[model samples]
Target: MSEVQQARPTLLYVDDEDMARKYFARAVGSEYEVLLAASAEEAIATLATDGARIAVLVTDFRMPGRDGGELLREVAQLYPQIVRILVTAYADKDMLLQTVNSGEVFRILEKPLSVAQVREVLRLAGERHRERALRQHRLMAIDETLAFLAHELNTPLAAIANFARGIESRVAGEYTEQRQGEIGQAASAMHDNAQYCLAVLSSFLQSVRNSAGSKAARPEPGAEVSAGALVASLLDTYPFSGDQRQWVQVEMHGDFPVQTLPNCVALVLSSVMSNALRALAGTPSPALRFVVVAQPHLEIHISDNGPGIPPEVMERLLVDPVTTHASAGGSGLGMIFCNRVMQSFGGGIRIASASGAGTTVTLDFPSFKNRMIRSDR
Candidate 1:
């Protein structure tokens, strides 16, 4: 398509009179591609087909079928991106008052539309649409950056803190069994988490720099690890407090090679474990189980017997970052991170929960035979 065909913003003009529609179209045909509708019903039908292309909707208030206010409300609900203009001959204070306060009308014009006035309003409406779209795009970018940073850096930073504390305790106490094994583990955890932190920061910096035109390079594929060994390594390195480890039960039915990024899998596991432990914090006989299946599909079930999510809260779990432990500095991106990581490798998560029935979260990875179907997207 040529510049003339694609550059002009679309305007949908609705009026009852045929002369008015033709006059309005002739007035603004040079700058805008105007679509005419004889009545509100025809306007809606036009919008239903070309809503995405429409940048502005100017409607006459006193129509035969539905009034302009009704059409404006419907347009606002269905196609909020379309800027709305109300045109009326009468100075009805009640209608104008309601329309103005409701934040639906962008601009109101008199019935006898002036050519200059229509052109200027359309230009201003197009500018407003562009500005609002830019603002929304920026807001979404900020949200995504925040979520990515929180999800990626959280586990390593937390592990570093816990491992440092363990090291401090060992140093303060005498050299015994605690110092023999605990100190080594703490030192290793510290080194590993510190390295992971550095890697995460470097990756984030590269991502920020290349966010616009350039695409970041795909990560190097990690070496395949058996499902059983991966779980063992995760449980051993995970930062667990006193008796928290005892509350967790692991049962591996069989072994299968998992080709997904080990670090990402570890990241997903860390988030799930954190959520499960938080849920079981105050419950009597709290049980957190990691059940692995290596048959048809490689599945890890993280089940916890704690108070299940409320209905209202559960509705927005995967959709938004909803948290129950916001007071404890919870980012509420655990499940979001888990789902994102799993889906990156042709897998997804299944959540089953009720008010008091506890919750079961299953990490559904591709089956062994279908492991090659991993997707980076």
Candidate 2:
């Protein structure tokens, strides 16, 4: 066998008939490392010995002395990741329904199985098995990397925060009123930025830690906050480069009070802003327009004049991590993370874009009354 064939996941096929087992192995042996057993008991023993290497399991449902349904139930409990497919000549609808309802089988194949049918079924099963394994591996890798990055960032962030505070204190005490006005503004900006960084770091670390474990992370319950104030604070504290800060504008329509976790909201807005800045990197005159409209529902729209998202990418942007600029260190997790946070709050995010026109991301928050109703429920 070639190295590629040897690396293929093993597919276990069980049947009582010699011809069926031999036919299956002959048909799928080239695509997968095929394992054959004559009975359910033999299949069970094989699985017990080498189940970890087996990605897909195909078994005849009518095997004597321990049927496929019972064996599948056992496999579901013992090796849940293995994709199970049932092949049977029997027209027992109830047994097939039970097998499917119990979620013990990935697919059902009726017999006198042709080579073409078996090949297609095995192909789908193999694809599913590989996809599940790859997803699990990626998640594990992301969790470990994020945990390490969070730990390394904590100490330096704390030191920088402390230093910013010291600068503010010294400026207040040593400088005259006139000098303090000019120097204190810079010190206060530094202090504000440091505090914002700490807040973002804490929120991100907590989110990663929560996801790494089995339990889902719940957002802190609502707090009454001024929506206008929250947006203004995020805009002021975001680390904008020279001439970039001048290109952004914010407008608040009316008094907007929202009841939600401020830090979560801030993180979402910051991520949107960060993406906008990155997209507008090479534009001649980039501009960001932010508008907050308070009414039946709270709507915050952030529009940027930059190269818009491509059609193919915009379709699955939130569903997966995809970046147009991978060379610039974009993992494409920002929008996905923001979407999850919004879902936790019973809110949602929407993106509208056209190629070369620009992109506008809208954040919709549940109204105050609706938030209260949700909390009460």
Candidate 3:
């Protein structure tokens, strides 16, 4: 099976009836990884698969041994994240009432169920799963953001302090033009750091405000701004020293078509680029290439000739909702924000890196009607 198939949701159904188990498995097993359990005991055994694979659970209330209610209660304690469905006959009033009131079940399925009803329930269950996943992602993002923010704030604060003290020490000496230039650069870096902090704060505040609102608005297509222009503007605003700024080469390989896209999308792209710059800082060369290419789709590639990520780290970085690297100030928040933005925009971000070669991040945004990239030739 392909990687995508391996990532598909797994549904576990527990029922003592052979025919019911066979039929349900045949109906939904084509789309999902379906696991069958003839008794509650079998279901309990299946739950032992590290609880990482089971996405949903469907159990018959009146199983032969160790009934569904009992099994569900166990599942609730063990795998609370998995959506639970209680299947029962019409006459099982006591069990049905207990299942509904106990809160262990997400939804109850009546026996002799219509295929349409089953499909509808499964559809809603899938939505619930998505929402749960999103919430977990957001929480992880917040954690990573706070970590990165602390690191970002500290670097500049330390620089300002060190530079001021150094300048004071050299005030009485014959300060050369080079010395003066160095002082000025230090000051600029400190200022840029402050500005970056403010931008981050503003983004956080806006997110909070939007979350509190009843209706959230999504930007319409045809309004996409110039990705290159936006990156240039942000780079201009941020606290990059002259040396740091020089290493960041922004190239528009193809005329990047401008399509109306949501502002969050822009922020995501900016954050990833910003992180790339920071990551590149640790390298001896300190060079970063920001290439925006227009092809069948919009491809935003940010690469740096820094110490490339390790194989293990790269693997987790791609799949992890929240992951942090020691060099990136251990703030995994930028990646989470990038992933969330791409998902919302119907696009995706891919990261590639080798131990010594460097790292490249590619953001593929959805294509919409817009002016094509004009050829330079």
Predicted structure with the largest TM-score when compared to the true one: 1
Work out the TM-score per prediction: 0.47, 0.43, 0.42
| Worst window of 10 by summed lDDT in candidate 3 | 368-377
lDDT (10s digit) by residue, model 2, range 150-177: 6788778778767866776788768789
Model 3: colliding residue pairs? 192-239, 222-260, 223-260, 224-259, 224-260, 255-373
Per-residue alpha-carbon lDDT of candidate 3 for residues 24-57, written as tens digits (9 for 90 to 100):
9888876778899899888877777535567788
Give candidate 3 misplaced runs (Cα > 4 Å): 1-224, 257-262, 321-329, 370-377
Model 2 has an lDDT value of 0.75
Candidate 1 lDDT, tens digit per residue, 1-377?
Answer: 65554588889999999999999999999998999998989998897677767889999999887888888876765565678999999999888877876667899999688888988898899998887667646644663675478567867776776676667556644677666566766665565445434434443333333233321111112223556665676676655656888988999888665544444565566667767877887799889989889767788888999998888878888879888766555556767877988897788998888888888888888763342222100
> Model 1 scores what on Cα lDDT?
0.72
lDDT of each candidate versus the true structure: 0.72, 0.75, 0.66
Clashing pairs in 2: none
Give candidate 1's error at residue 229 in angstroms.
36
lDDT, candidate 1, at 81: 65
Highest lDDT scorer: 2
Order of models, best lDDT first: 2, 1, 3
* Model 1's TM-score against the true structure: 0.47
